[model samples]
Target: MSEKKNEGNSVSRRSFLRNGALAAAGFMIVPRHVLGRGFVAPSDRLRVAAVGVGGKGYGDITSFAEGRADIAFLCDVDKRRAAKAITTFPKAKFYTDYREMFEKERKNFDAVSVSTPDHQHAVAAMAAMQLGKHVYVQKPLTHDIYEARKLTEAAKKYKVVTQMGNQGASGDGVRQLMEWYNAGLIGDVHTVYVWTDRPVWPQGVAWPQTNATIPAELNWDLWLGTAPKKNFVDNLVPFNWRGWWDYGTGALGDMGCHLIEPPFRVLGLGYPSSVEASVGSVYVGEFNRGYFPESCPPSSHVTMKFPVKGGKEVTMHWMDGGIQPERPEELGPNEMMGDGGNGVIFVGTKGKMMCGTYGINPRLLPTSRNAEVNVPQTIARVPEGHYLQWVNAAIAGYNSKEAKSLSSPFDIAGPLTESILMGNLAIRSYDYREAKIDGKGYNYPGRYIKLLWDGPNMKITNFDPANQFVKRTYREGWSLGV
Candidate 1:
């Protein structure tokens, strides 16, 4: 697409409403309360298809199917998963390949819920939107930074009601946190410590020891999708793929959207000025193979510096693999730190607000005041469920003020995804050099430098090679287009 064309298709409030109205006219309209209550009236039932019906995918489908949406199609590379999902929607058609599902059943679905791995999110969502189907895509919006940008562009071009799968975006807790921040409870935030105990679920301490045979039930080629082909290993299939560099974005990408989204939303954080990483590795022999490639540091500690629209700087630190910053002494003996996996602790000039992935019921505190700070009531509350919001939006079109208000379009989702991926890039760069923090006198090995960014140019002025990782070549026939 030309620069002009791409810019024109970028997300905007006006475009969102226009597309929403167009989509609403085609689908059956139901009462707003019906959708809000998680029930779909018979006439307003959305004909839906779920791509990547595994782990999270199954949960997303069940949420919709149990509600008012009709599951017309279930697609997965694994027959076991496909079969299991099929039982729930016995009448829904099933497919091993999603492209085939779209081609044959295009007319049947009013919307699609994409629950695929990171690499496949863009392709499946793009295809669905192109067909004029509404989309609810799980977060860390896209596999790579470019894809997130493109998907956001496509959502606008197609005039579809689109939502990122950061379900917490709809939560009342998250909204309250944002309101608190906006109300100056935290007072001029400058730094944040967000850590997760993730990858523990799927991230291996080390890479798989041996390549196990691929199961016959799984279509290994289709599973690889746009990533380079590799021999199928039993450990790499099903759920463990999150540790690998190709299929997943490791711990950061997996949980960044959920954990970092609140700060991003309330702060209106734009692009980062620079990023650096520190981490542990497991390279044992001549060939370097850690849990992730030595080239892609296994347990990463990344710091990103963002120069907001104004002159102020916002620095964020992210660590995975059960690592966490020292807890503030102010937290009372009864105030236990939440689970390590995917949480953010905002450090402001005055106080702090801490939250976990999905930003569920975040807590606020004063540095010295031990007791929890009383926060006032706010107007916005997180929506009931992320998936349900998208469904309602798809049916009513952008015209439903309720749906538009609850949704997080690509504009918001795209930058958040970009910020998350910065950590990944910093991890990769750490393998090459030493880095220095802005104010800290400490210098460390394998530290990535903070390169200035030009978002529109998609370039890092000081880092030439780093810019290349932002975009990747897609396998033929599977590549996305404007």
Candidate 2:
């Protein structure tokens, strides 16, 4: 007890700070357990700073807080939207721009969680990663394929722990499906059908005229981030941005991670070899198609081909905007298909299996079989769940002894997200056209050709025009830097 012992033998905050010459000079100040109650071990807790603390952002940041990580800072472009989170973490320093927050609070946080609009995810997450901070980002990993590729590469180079907010990837249900599939329950899955009733917002139309005034509590310019400049429009903030190509990735982007991750994980699926799609269109008053380039089509069905698991090639079908595939024959007349609105189905050589959103309620085809069949539990269940999985992994650090297990780390999630977005590429390219060689009028060329993808190079080999979408042009001030 020669170490200037306090009455209770616990290190006080004042004592810890005064004794922190070691910490100030780069050393472990003290073990958390030895420091006693109310004192989080320097090595135990993750200091987290979150950007976009509203809507889904609120839930994401709160998960880390409740999981025992410290919420050291909060940043958001919309103050009014962020009110709930601000109230929730009153002591957290707040900023309007994530860049400013990162610049100032870089030393204060161990990790960053991003829940901004799709376009903002990569810019914020990559900036934090460049600083060597671990990150947990809301899914579809980035707004474009190029951003996804870069972030994936940076995560390894920076050596930071990472995870995506596709909580279902950490769910027991998907693992159960994997176990069942591995046990030869469903045989080799040759086709997967994932469908959703989304666009819950507007799509398949012209972008709204932007005469409406921007809300005073919202920073319109900062909120625009890497997106092209546009006048503020009502109903576009908070949620409806999902419909716009510049800001959101539409219904497919919104739900694809949850619905598609299982198939990718269970089958060890990688990039697609080809992609094709048919989209629902708005005709207005005439039978002729009304092409609204700015907004996502109301509905779409995209099919992608992937080399099968040591066998034949496989196909994955993605449907959105309330469209769904036909019910399997093994499912009874009364049995609900894929939890009603959203679901996934795998048709294999032996039989079929399926699940609902977030991979909940996984069941084999023929309702009676689910109850009768039991498979060995193989994958470890994440204690606490998805939010805590990253919290624990981050706290464990990249090289921790216990070995943090992140279900959706960027290494896995980045490629999975790229595959999901490839569906969107096909959908967007479907509308591309060229002047007819006959010199009379326009002919839809991309409409007829199947986009042959060279996954390794991230390009469409057959169509040069469709290659433009692999990356996007950022506004003058913003770029996804190395």
Candidate 3:
């Protein structure tokens, strides 16, 4: 397939001379590899600049530099968080602000690695793309629907290599799922369920009333890039932001990509036509329902409707905050369903299939069937794992054969992210309310509404107000070029 052309291109001598000319002009210099993608000398490694080089960000850059490339620059809002990366790559220049890093080291690195919070992913990646550098961004792509769409288009417009951090996309499990689907093992998967026990962070709570002092090692303003200005709250940084609307998208955003990718890849699914949701409530004291607009509910269940390749459609159910679907009777009493913490189950006409996070431990219904049934492996696997998939692709350059084979390039990640965020839109819209005409009570106008989606237009057809969530307005100084 043209989409999988990373391994099939033949290079000519003319391209080599052009590479030479670019190098002579002080462009990204590197040695040519025998694979014909780019240079391969040990000393000529692809140079990478990393933003938010801590936590998952640290793991990302470390994987990129794991004997394959040079960690040329490091940037993070909190030095305390990025401590490991700073010491790990002692020679990699460090910066508190990623804007300064890109501006100063524009020509130093051939690629950029972005592991910032969901809100900042787009701006940092776009800056790198604007400078003609390849980028590997973390999953769920962007915080808002418009940002995701913009980045997806930019990948092609700028002709840059791109990969999202949903590592399961590159795993053999999803490939196996695809092969099984191609073999008609799960015929016409009409109903599906994906559940997670996340929100390991706080949710369904009101914002802290007291303002706390900013940590000495953290740049609070830089960390809040694109997010509206807010007073520092204790324990909001490093973690726990997952529950808040401004900096995070709750448990769904944290784990949706991993659990949902199996169905998306296997069934060749696209945008959903409609989505509806019901959220778990946290009661204040014993009677009153707590209202926390800034926080995600403690639990939620979202249902989405999507039309398949045929005229028929499929229904998907997503649950989080320790909730799960009823266990199928096909398995033993003590059998595992989606590895306990997170899992996916596809209910098809013929049979059922399931997997855990990152599409791992895929199995057909009736546990013994995994070994008894065999399907041809039609899809290729990423040999070195997800992080390195981006590394190798970047070294191969934009539009090169290698870049085409990426598992979660923007083209693939964009729609997937949009679909995931659509669930959030439904969840948020579910809470839409108005002051009652009586002036003494409140009314939930959005309750019981199955929001219709116009995917191409990025809007809700029936409810006009819900469109506000589709593309958020950034703060005064923050912009996504939207």
lDDT tens string, model 3, 212-329? 9999999898888777899999988888888998989889988998888889888888999998888887767655576576788899999999998769998999999999999987
Candidate scoring better on lDDT of 2 and 3: 2
The lDDT values for all models are 0.72, 0.83, 0.82
Where model 1 places Cα greater than 4 Å from the true spot, the runs are 1-43, 201-211, 283-296, 366-375, 430-447
Candidate 1 structure lDDT: 0.72
The candidate, 1 or 2, that scores higher on lDDT is: 2
Question: Could you tell me which 10 consecutive residues in candidate 3 have the lowest summed lDDT?
Answer: 1-10
Error of 2 at 56 (Å): 0.5
Candidate 2 lDDT (Cα, whole model)?
Answer: 0.83
| lDDT of predicted model 3 | 0.82
lDDT tens readout by residue for model 1, 129-242: 877788888887887878888887877777778888887777776787777787887788899888887775455344556787777788888888777767766666676677
lDDT of 2 by residue, 383-435 (tens): 68999878887777677642356799888999998998888888777334553
Query: Could you arrange the candidates by lDDT from highest to lowest?
Result: 2, 3, 1
